[model samples]
Target: MKADVMPKPQNMFQAYMLLFLISSGQIGVGIFGFQRIVGMHSDHDAWISVIVAGIVSHIVVGLMFWILSKHESADLYGIHQHLFGRWIGNGLSMVMMVYYVMVSVTIVRTYIELIQSWIFPTFPTWVLSMTLLLLAWYGITGGIRLIAGLSTISFFVILFFIGTLYISPIKYASWSHLLPIGETSPWAIMKGTISMGLTISGFESIFYIYPYIKDKSNGAKYAQYSLLFSNIIYLFMMIMGIVYFSKGQLTRSIWASTSMLKIVKFPFLERLEYIASSVWMFVVIPGLMIYIWVLGRGFKRMMGWKQRMMTPIICFVIFIGSLISQDREHIHMLSTFTGRCALFVVFLYPVVLFLFQTLILGIRDQSDKKGAAE
Candidate 1:
C-alpha cells in the first residue's frame, strides 16, 4: 500500500521573535563576567571596547544578512553545499556541527562552574550538566517555535532582572572610576573589543535561523535591531562594572556582574547575587537551546538522523565532556580557547564566505545573462 503524503509544512516564526532569539542567545554566560575579559586589555576603558564591539557586531550581522538574503530559501548548510562541492560542503557542515556542540558545552560547563562557585560549592559538574542538557534536550525536541517562545519569555525575565542593577549596590559605584577614558592604548582597546566581540558572537545564529523566518525580507532589519540591543546591554553592563569596580577590583572579579549584585541590600532580599545568579539560568539557557537545536538540525540534515534521536546523544557527549575538567584554571583555559575560536569563526568566516559567495554568484549571473543575450 502507498503511504499518505501530506506532511505539515514547518511553521515559521514572525520577525520580532528574531529579536528575542538573537538577543537572548547573545546574552549568555559570557556577560556574567565579560568585564574582566575586556578589562584585561583596556583596563577601565573597556566600555569603549564594548561600544566598538557593538559596531563590529552590527557590521558582521549586515554581512551575514547580505549573504543570506541572496538565497532566502537556503540555510547556511545548503549555501555551503552550493558554493562548495558536496563532499567539501558536507565536511564544513560537520565542522560547524561540532562548533555548535562545543558552544553548547562551553555554555553548560561555564554556567555549572558559576553555580558551583557561588551557590553550591560541592555540586558535581556532571549532574548539573546533565540537568541543563536534559532541559535543552526537551526543548530541542519540541521544535523551533517552542524554542522561540521560551526565548521571548526569557528575554522579559532578563529585562526585569536588569532592574536589580538599579538597586542599592549601584550607589557604591564611583563614576570617577571611569575617568580618563582614553588612557588605554589603541592596540589594547582593539584587543578588548575582540574580547567583547566574543561575548557578542551569538548573532551568527542568523545563518541557521534565516530560513525559519516568516517575513524573510524583514528578517535582517530585526536581526540588526537585536544585535544593537545586545550591544546596548553589554555596554551598559560594562559601564556599570567599570564605575562600580576599580581596574584592580574588576581584574579580581571572576563574575563581575554577579559580584556587583553582592552589595545590593533590601529589607526582603539578603543575598542579591544568589538571586541574580539563579535568574541567570534563564539567560544562559536560550544560548544553550539554540546551539543544541542547531546541532540536532545539522546532524539530521547531514546524516538522515532524527533530531529527537540526535538530541540525547549530543547531550550525553556534552555531559561526559563536561566531566573532564574540574579545576578552575582548566575551565578558564577551555573557555578562553573556545572564545578565541568563536571570535575567528563568528567574525572572520562570515566575511570570507560572503566575499567568495558574492563573487561566485556575480560571475554566474553575468554568464547567464550573456547566454540569454546570445
Candidate 2:
C-alpha cells in the first residue's frame, strides 16, 4: 500500500514499514504449529517442504506485487471489478471478502487454541477471542500506517525471542534421520507443499495496500525482497524443527517448535518456552490486526462503507466465528479445512488473475496496433 494511506513517512525506511509490517503478518502463530504439520507428511526432510513453500510463496507474492504495480493506485477489490466487470467483479470481490474474513477467523482460532493448549488451559475462548478482536480493532482504527510502523518493533521482539532456537535445544537434532532427504516421492512433497501454502498466506498485503506504495516502479522489487526474507526465516524455523524434534517426535507433536523450547533450560528459568511464547503474543497480534484490516478494506471498497464503522463490525464477526470452535480438535479440523481452501487464493488466484489480465493486456495492445495503422 502507498505510504500515504495512513502516515506519510518522512523517509524511505518509514515508507518500507509496509514491507516489514506485511512480512510480520506473514510470520504469525502458524509458524509455531507448522513444523508438526509439515513433519507429518514430509518427515525430517520437512525442512525441504518449507524451502519448497518458500519458492512457491515467492512466485505467488511476486505475482501479487506485479499485479498491484500494473494498476498503480487500485486495491484488489478494484482490480477484481476492473478485470471481471461490474457484476462478475463485484461477485468475485464478495468471495474475496469472505476469503479474507475466513483468514482473520483462522488466526483468532489458531491463537486462542495455542494459548489454551500451551499456556492458559482454563481460559474461556470467547473472552480470549474477544480480547484479541478488540486489540486488533484498536490497531485497525488507528489505521494501517500505525500497523506498518509498529511492525518493525513487533518483528524485532519476535526475532529476539526466537533466538532460543539456536541454543541447546538444537543439540536434539539427529543427523541420521535426515540423511536421506527426498526419500519421499515427488508427489509427497507437492502434496505437502499445499499445507505449507496455508502457512504462508501473508502475501495478501500487496493486494490490500497497493494504493499506498511510495513508488510503484519499485513495488515489485520490494515485494520480491520481502518474499526472499520471509523464505529464509521460514526455512530456518523448519530446519530447526526437524533437527531438534526428529521425524517421529515432530509427526506426533503439536506446536513442535514451541514445545521443543519447553526442554530448553536457562540459568534463570526452566520453562523457557513459556517465557519465549509470552512475548510472541505481539508477533501474532499484528498479523491478526492486519488481516482484519485487510478484510475491512476489501469490504469497504466493495460496499462503499466507511473504515471507521467497518473495522469494529468485522472484528465482531470474526470474534463470533472464533467462539464456535469447541476444543482443540475442532480448531484443528477448521485449520485443516481452511488451509485447504486458502490454497486457491494464495497459489491459484494469482495464476488466474495473471491469465485474465494478460488477455486483457494483449487485446489492448492489438487495439493499439490497429489504431496506429488506421
Best by TM-score: 1
Pairs of residues at least 3 apart in sequence or in different chains that clash in candidate 2: 1-209, 1-212, 1-213, 2-211, 2-212, 2-213, 3-212, 173-243
TM-score of each: 0.95, 0.92
Candidate 2, residues 112-167, lDDT tens digits: the string is 77788778899998998888888888887878777876777777876676664556
Looking at model 2, residue 324 earns an lDDT score of 85
- Kindly give the stretch of ten consecutive residues in candidate 2 with the minimal lDDT sum: 1-10
Candidate 1: worst 10 consecutive residues by lDDT?
1-10
Clash totals for all models, in order? 0, 8
Model 2 segments beyond 4 Å from truth? 1-15, 365-374
The TM-score of predicted model 2 comes to: 0.92
For model 2, what is the error of residue 369's alpha carbon versus the real structure, in angstroms, after optimal superposition? Answer: 5.8
Model 2: lDDT equals: 0.77
Cα-lDDT of candidate 1: 0.83
Candidate 1: give the clashing pairs: none
